[model samples]
Target: MIELVRPHAALVEAWNEAHREWGPGLHEDGFGIGAEDDVDTIEGIQAWIARTQQESGELWWIVEDGEVLGGIALRSADDERVHRFGHIGYGIRPSARGRGVATWALGEVLRHARSSGINPVLAFCAETNAGSIATLEHHGAELEAVEQRGDTRVRRYAISY
Candidate 1:
Protein backbone atom coordinates (compact mmCIF):
# COMPACT_ATOMS: atom_id res chain seq x y z
CA MET A 1 0.00 0.00 0.00
CA ILE A 2 0.99 3.64 -0.50
CA GLU A 3 0.89 6.30 2.19
CA LEU A 4 0.88 10.09 1.92
CA VAL A 5 3.18 11.81 4.37
CA ARG A 6 5.02 14.90 5.42
CA PRO A 7 8.61 14.97 4.17
CA HIS A 8 10.69 13.70 7.03
CA ALA A 9 14.42 13.65 7.44
CA ALA A 10 14.67 9.91 7.11
CA LEU A 11 12.76 9.80 3.85
CA VAL A 12 14.95 12.56 2.55
CA GLU A 13 17.99 10.47 3.41
CA ALA A 14 16.67 7.54 1.46
CA TRP A 15 15.74 9.60 -1.55
CA ASN A 16 19.17 11.16 -1.52
CA GLU A 17 20.88 7.83 -1.60
CA ALA A 18 18.63 6.40 -4.25
CA HIS A 19 18.66 9.45 -6.45
CA ARG A 20 22.39 9.75 -6.21
CA GLU A 21 23.12 6.25 -7.35
CA TRP A 22 20.39 5.73 -9.91
CA GLY A 23 18.13 8.69 -10.46
CA PRO A 24 17.03 8.14 -13.98
CA GLY A 25 16.61 4.36 -13.74
CA LEU A 26 13.94 3.39 -16.20
CA HIS A 27 12.61 6.91 -16.18
CA GLU A 28 15.59 8.14 -18.16
CA ASP A 29 13.23 9.74 -20.60
CA GLY A 30 12.45 12.29 -17.91
CA PHE A 31 16.09 12.93 -17.05
CA GLY A 32 16.32 16.57 -18.06
CA ILE A 33 12.95 17.18 -19.53
CA GLY A 34 9.46 17.14 -18.06
CA ALA A 35 10.51 15.60 -14.77
CA GLU A 36 12.36 16.50 -11.59
CA ASP A 37 15.77 18.05 -11.75
CA ASP A 38 18.50 15.67 -10.66
CA VAL A 39 19.01 15.96 -6.93
CA ASP A 40 22.27 14.61 -5.48
CA THR A 41 22.20 15.18 -1.77
CA ILE A 42 20.05 14.45 1.24
CA GLU A 43 20.19 18.04 2.42
CA GLY A 44 19.03 19.31 -0.93
CA ILE A 45 16.14 16.89 -1.05
CA GLN A 46 15.18 17.75 2.49
CA ALA A 47 15.12 21.42 1.70
CA TRP A 48 13.13 20.90 -1.45
CA ILE A 49 10.64 18.68 0.35
CA ALA A 50 10.32 21.08 3.25
CA ARG A 51 9.76 24.02 1.01
CA THR A 52 7.18 22.29 -1.10
CA GLN A 53 5.34 20.85 1.86
CA GLN A 54 5.32 24.05 3.85
CA GLU A 55 4.61 26.43 1.02
CA SER A 56 2.26 24.58 -1.27
CA GLY A 57 0.30 21.96 0.65
CA GLU A 58 2.50 19.38 -0.98
CA LEU A 59 2.72 15.93 0.52
CA TRP A 60 5.85 13.85 0.31
CA TRP A 61 5.35 10.14 0.58
CA ILE A 62 7.34 6.93 0.58
CA VAL A 63 6.05 4.05 -1.40
CA GLU A 64 7.02 1.29 0.89
CA ASP A 65 6.11 -1.48 3.25
CA GLY A 66 8.64 -0.74 5.97
CA GLU A 67 11.18 0.15 3.29
CA VAL A 68 11.24 3.15 0.99
CA LEU A 69 10.76 1.67 -2.42
CA GLY A 70 10.24 5.05 -4.00
CA GLY A 71 9.19 8.63 -3.36
CA ILE A 72 6.33 10.81 -4.56
CA ALA A 73 5.33 14.42 -4.09
CA LEU A 74 1.85 15.79 -4.60
CA ARG A 75 1.61 19.54 -4.79
CA SER A 76 -1.35 21.90 -4.58
CA ALA A 77 0.23 25.10 -3.50
CA ASP A 78 0.03 26.76 -6.85
CA ASP A 79 1.96 29.83 -7.72
CA GLU A 80 1.47 32.53 -10.35
CA ARG A 81 2.57 29.77 -12.67
CA VAL A 82 0.45 27.08 -11.00
CA HIS A 83 -2.44 28.42 -8.86
CA ARG A 84 -5.26 26.97 -10.94
CA PHE A 85 -3.14 24.00 -11.88
CA GLY A 86 -1.32 21.33 -9.86
CA HIS A 87 1.58 19.07 -10.64
CA ILE A 88 2.82 15.72 -9.33
CA GLY A 89 6.36 14.41 -9.41
CA TYR A 90 7.67 11.06 -8.32
CA GLY A 91 10.36 8.41 -8.75
CA ILE A 92 11.20 4.87 -7.70
CA ARG A 93 14.54 3.53 -6.57
CA PRO A 94 16.49 1.54 -9.12
CA SER A 95 16.12 -1.52 -6.94
CA ALA A 96 12.35 -1.13 -6.86
CA ARG A 97 11.51 -0.21 -10.38
CA GLY A 98 8.74 -2.16 -12.23
CA ARG A 99 6.91 -3.13 -9.08
CA GLY A 100 3.84 -0.93 -9.65
CA VAL A 101 4.75 1.30 -6.73
CA ALA A 102 4.58 4.49 -8.79
CA THR A 103 1.28 3.47 -10.27
CA TRP A 104 -0.26 2.77 -6.89
CA ALA A 105 1.14 5.87 -5.25
CA LEU A 106 -0.35 7.93 -8.05
CA GLY A 107 -3.68 6.33 -7.40
CA GLU A 108 -3.35 7.46 -3.83
CA VAL A 109 -2.45 10.94 -4.99
CA LEU A 110 -5.50 11.08 -7.20
CA ARG A 111 -7.72 10.17 -4.27
CA HIS A 112 -6.04 12.82 -2.18
CA ALA A 113 -6.47 15.32 -4.95
CA ARG A 114 -10.19 14.62 -5.05
CA SER A 115 -10.48 15.08 -1.33
CA SER A 116 -8.46 18.27 -1.44
CA GLY A 117 -10.82 19.67 -4.07
CA ILE A 118 -8.02 20.07 -6.56
CA ASN A 119 -9.81 18.73 -9.54
CA PRO A 120 -8.12 18.26 -12.84
CA VAL A 121 -4.49 18.04 -11.83
CA LEU A 122 -2.19 18.74 -14.72
CA ALA A 123 0.97 16.68 -14.99
CA PHE A 124 3.84 16.62 -17.43
CA CYS A 125 5.80 13.55 -18.42
CA ALA A 126 8.36 13.21 -21.12
CA GLU A 127 6.94 12.02 -24.42
CA THR A 128 9.43 9.21 -24.42
CA ASN A 129 8.38 8.01 -20.99
CA ALA A 130 6.04 5.33 -22.16
CA GLY A 131 5.72 3.74 -18.74
CA SER A 132 4.58 6.92 -17.05
CA ILE A 133 2.37 7.89 -19.97
CA ALA A 134 0.75 4.50 -19.90
CA THR A 135 0.31 4.64 -16.17
CA LEU A 136 -1.36 8.04 -16.28
CA GLU A 137 -3.64 6.98 -19.08
CA HIS A 138 -4.59 3.89 -17.14
CA HIS A 139 -5.58 6.13 -14.27
CA GLY A 140 -7.82 8.20 -16.54
CA ALA A 141 -5.63 11.13 -17.44
CA GLU A 142 -6.19 12.54 -20.86
CA LEU A 143 -3.41 13.89 -22.99
CA GLU A 144 -3.98 17.59 -23.43
CA ALA A 145 -0.86 18.97 -25.02
CA VAL A 146 2.55 18.11 -26.36
CA GLU A 147 5.29 20.67 -26.07
CA GLN A 148 9.03 21.02 -26.27
CA ARG A 149 11.46 21.82 -23.54
CA GLY A 150 14.97 22.49 -24.76
CA ASP A 151 15.73 19.43 -26.87
CA THR A 152 13.08 17.23 -25.24
CA ARG A 153 9.43 16.61 -26.01
CA VAL A 154 6.95 16.63 -23.17
CA ARG A 155 3.36 15.53 -23.02
CA ARG A 156 0.93 17.19 -20.67
CA TYR A 157 -1.98 15.32 -19.17
CA ALA A 158 -4.87 16.12 -16.86
CA ILE A 159 -6.93 14.03 -14.49
CA SER A 160 -10.23 15.50 -13.34
CA TYR A 161 -11.06 14.70 -9.77
Candidate 2:
Protein backbone atom coordinates (compact mmCIF):
# COMPACT_ATOMS: atom_id res chain seq x y z
CA MET A 1 0.00 0.00 0.00
CA ILE A 2 3.06 2.27 -0.04
CA GLU A 3 3.77 4.60 -2.96
CA LEU A 4 6.05 7.49 -3.90
CA VAL A 5 4.66 10.86 -4.95
CA ARG A 6 6.35 14.10 -5.84
CA PRO A 7 6.49 16.66 -3.01
CA HIS A 8 3.84 19.36 -3.32
CA ALA A 9 2.79 22.47 -1.42
CA ALA A 10 -0.54 20.90 -0.50
CA LEU A 11 1.28 18.42 1.73
CA VAL A 12 3.13 21.07 3.72
CA GLU A 13 0.88 20.83 6.73
CA ALA A 14 1.22 17.06 6.90
CA TRP A 15 4.94 17.29 6.39
CA ASN A 16 5.23 19.80 9.19
CA GLU A 17 3.19 17.64 11.49
CA ALA A 18 5.42 14.71 10.84
CA HIS A 19 8.42 16.88 11.48
CA ARG A 20 7.02 17.94 14.81
CA GLU A 21 6.41 14.31 15.76
CA TRP A 22 9.90 13.31 14.78
CA GLY A 23 11.41 16.12 16.79
CA PRO A 24 13.53 18.96 15.45
CA GLY A 25 15.95 19.01 12.51
CA LEU A 26 14.62 15.94 10.75
CA HIS A 27 14.96 17.52 7.33
CA GLU A 28 18.12 19.32 6.32
CA ASP A 29 16.31 21.91 4.25
CA GLY A 30 13.90 22.62 7.11
CA PHE A 31 10.91 22.02 4.85
CA GLY A 32 8.28 23.53 7.11
CA ILE A 33 10.37 25.17 9.80
CA GLY A 34 10.73 28.86 10.14
CA ALA A 35 14.48 28.82 10.65
CA GLU A 36 17.10 31.02 9.13
CA ASP A 37 18.37 28.06 7.11
CA ASP A 38 15.04 26.31 6.56
CA VAL A 39 11.91 27.34 4.73
CA ASP A 40 9.84 29.69 6.89
CA THR A 41 6.77 30.05 4.65
CA ILE A 42 4.53 28.20 2.24
CA GLU A 43 6.00 30.10 -0.69
CA GLY A 44 9.48 29.04 0.41
CA ILE A 45 8.38 25.44 0.57
CA GLN A 46 6.95 25.69 -2.94
CA ALA A 47 10.17 27.18 -4.21
CA TRP A 48 12.17 24.36 -2.58
CA ILE A 49 9.99 21.80 -4.34
CA ALA A 50 10.44 23.58 -7.65
CA ARG A 51 14.20 23.67 -7.15
CA THR A 52 14.31 19.94 -6.56
CA GLN A 53 12.47 19.37 -9.85
CA GLN A 54 14.75 21.67 -11.80
CA GLU A 55 18.01 20.41 -10.29
CA SER A 56 17.75 16.82 -11.54
CA GLY A 57 17.13 15.77 -7.95
CA GLU A 58 13.97 13.82 -7.16
CA LEU A 59 12.21 14.06 -3.80
CA TRP A 60 9.09 12.03 -3.06
CA TRP A 61 6.79 11.46 -0.17
CA ILE A 62 6.48 7.87 0.96
CA VAL A 63 2.75 7.64 1.40
CA GLU A 64 0.36 4.92 2.44
CA ASP A 65 -3.30 5.65 1.95
CA GLY A 66 -3.10 9.44 1.91
CA GLU A 67 -0.71 10.10 4.80
CA VAL A 68 2.94 10.87 4.47
CA LEU A 69 4.88 8.10 6.20
CA GLY A 70 8.22 9.57 5.31
CA GLY A 71 10.30 10.87 2.42
CA ILE A 72 13.07 9.70 0.10
CA ALA A 73 15.30 11.48 -2.37
CA LEU A 74 17.24 10.33 -5.43
CA ARG A 75 19.71 12.28 -7.45
CA SER A 76 22.37 11.63 -10.04
CA ALA A 77 26.01 11.35 -9.01
CA ASP A 78 27.16 14.90 -9.36
CA ASP A 79 30.62 14.77 -7.84
CA GLU A 80 33.06 12.73 -5.81
CA ARG A 81 31.46 13.68 -2.51
CA VAL A 82 28.09 12.35 -3.67
CA HIS A 83 29.68 9.02 -4.52
CA ARG A 84 30.98 8.69 -0.99
CA PHE A 85 27.70 9.54 0.68
CA GLY A 86 25.37 7.62 -1.70
CA HIS A 87 22.79 8.94 -4.13
CA ILE A 88 19.75 8.05 -2.02
CA GLY A 89 18.65 9.10 1.47
CA TYR A 90 15.48 8.31 3.39
CA GLY A 91 13.75 8.53 6.74
CA ILE A 92 10.54 6.90 7.98
CA ARG A 93 8.33 8.25 10.70
CA PRO A 94 8.94 6.97 14.23
CA SER A 95 5.42 5.52 14.38
CA ALA A 96 6.03 3.58 11.17
CA ARG A 97 9.41 2.10 12.01
CA GLY A 98 10.03 -1.70 12.14
CA ARG A 99 7.15 -2.24 9.72
CA GLY A 100 9.28 -2.72 6.58
CA VAL A 101 8.60 0.82 5.39
CA ALA A 102 12.21 1.62 4.64
CA THR A 103 12.87 -1.70 2.95
CA TRP A 104 9.86 -1.22 0.71
CA ALA A 105 10.64 2.42 0.07
CA LEU A 106 14.21 1.60 -0.94
CA GLY A 107 12.98 -1.10 -3.30
CA GLU A 108 10.79 1.46 -5.02
CA VAL A 109 13.64 3.94 -5.21
CA LEU A 110 15.95 1.37 -6.76
CA ARG A 111 13.30 0.46 -9.31
CA HIS A 112 13.12 4.10 -10.29
CA ALA A 113 16.90 4.26 -10.48
CA ARG A 114 16.98 1.28 -12.83
CA SER A 115 14.32 2.84 -15.01
CA SER A 116 16.44 5.97 -15.20
CA GLY A 117 19.52 4.02 -16.35
CA ILE A 118 21.38 4.14 -13.06
CA ASN A 119 22.21 0.63 -12.00
CA PRO A 120 23.72 -0.29 -8.66
CA VAL A 121 22.83 2.68 -6.51
CA LEU A 122 25.12 3.65 -3.67
CA ALA A 123 23.86 3.92 -0.07
CA PHE A 124 25.98 4.91 2.87
CA CYS A 125 25.26 4.77 6.57
CA ALA A 126 27.22 5.32 9.73
CA GLU A 127 28.59 2.10 11.15
CA THR A 128 26.68 2.86 14.30
CA ASN A 129 23.33 2.82 12.51
CA ALA A 130 22.66 -0.88 12.71
CA GLY A 131 19.06 -0.53 11.59
CA SER A 132 20.02 1.29 8.44
CA ILE A 133 22.79 -1.21 7.72
CA ALA A 134 20.31 -4.03 8.17
CA THR A 135 17.84 -2.32 5.84
CA LEU A 136 20.47 -1.92 3.17
CA GLU A 137 21.51 -5.54 3.56
CA HIS A 138 17.90 -6.67 3.29
CA HIS A 139 17.83 -5.08 -0.17
CA GLY A 140 20.91 -7.03 -1.35
CA ALA A 141 23.27 -4.12 -0.99
CA GLU A 142 26.84 -5.30 -0.65
CA LEU A 143 29.44 -3.68 1.55
CA GLU A 144 31.68 -1.91 -0.90
CA ALA A 145 33.97 0.07 1.37
CA VAL A 146 34.30 1.88 4.62
CA GLU A 147 35.61 5.39 4.66
CA GLN A 148 36.17 8.09 7.20
CA ARG A 149 33.97 11.15 7.03
CA GLY A 150 35.18 13.75 9.45
CA ASP A 151 35.68 11.71 12.64
CA THR A 152 32.98 9.14 11.85
CA ARG A 153 33.30 5.95 9.86
CA VAL A 154 30.74 5.51 7.12
CA ARG A 155 29.90 2.17 5.55
CA ARG A 156 29.19 2.39 1.85
CA TYR A 157 26.81 -0.10 0.23
CA ALA A 158 26.20 -0.70 -3.44
CA ILE A 159 22.77 -1.91 -4.47
CA SER A 160 22.49 -3.33 -7.97
CA TYR A 161 19.42 -2.83 -10.09
Off by over 4 Å in 1: 23-49, 81-86
Candidate 1 weakest ten by summed lDDT: 28-37
List model 2 lDDT by residue over 1-161, tens digit each.
88888878777777766666777663432122224434446777677677766755577888887778888777776634357547788888788778988888888888888887776788888899787898899989999988898988989988885
Q: Residue 76 in candidate 2 has what lDDT?
A: 74
Look at candidate 1 and give me any clashing residue pairs: none
lDDT of 1 by residue, 1-161 (tens): 55655556766655455555664444522111123533455555555555555555455555455455665656664544343223676666667767677788788777777888877887778799887887788899999888888898988888885
**What's the residue-level lDDT of 156 in candidate 2?**
90
lDDT of 1: 0.63
TM-score of 1: 0.75
lDDT of each: 0.63, 0.74
Best by lDDT: 2
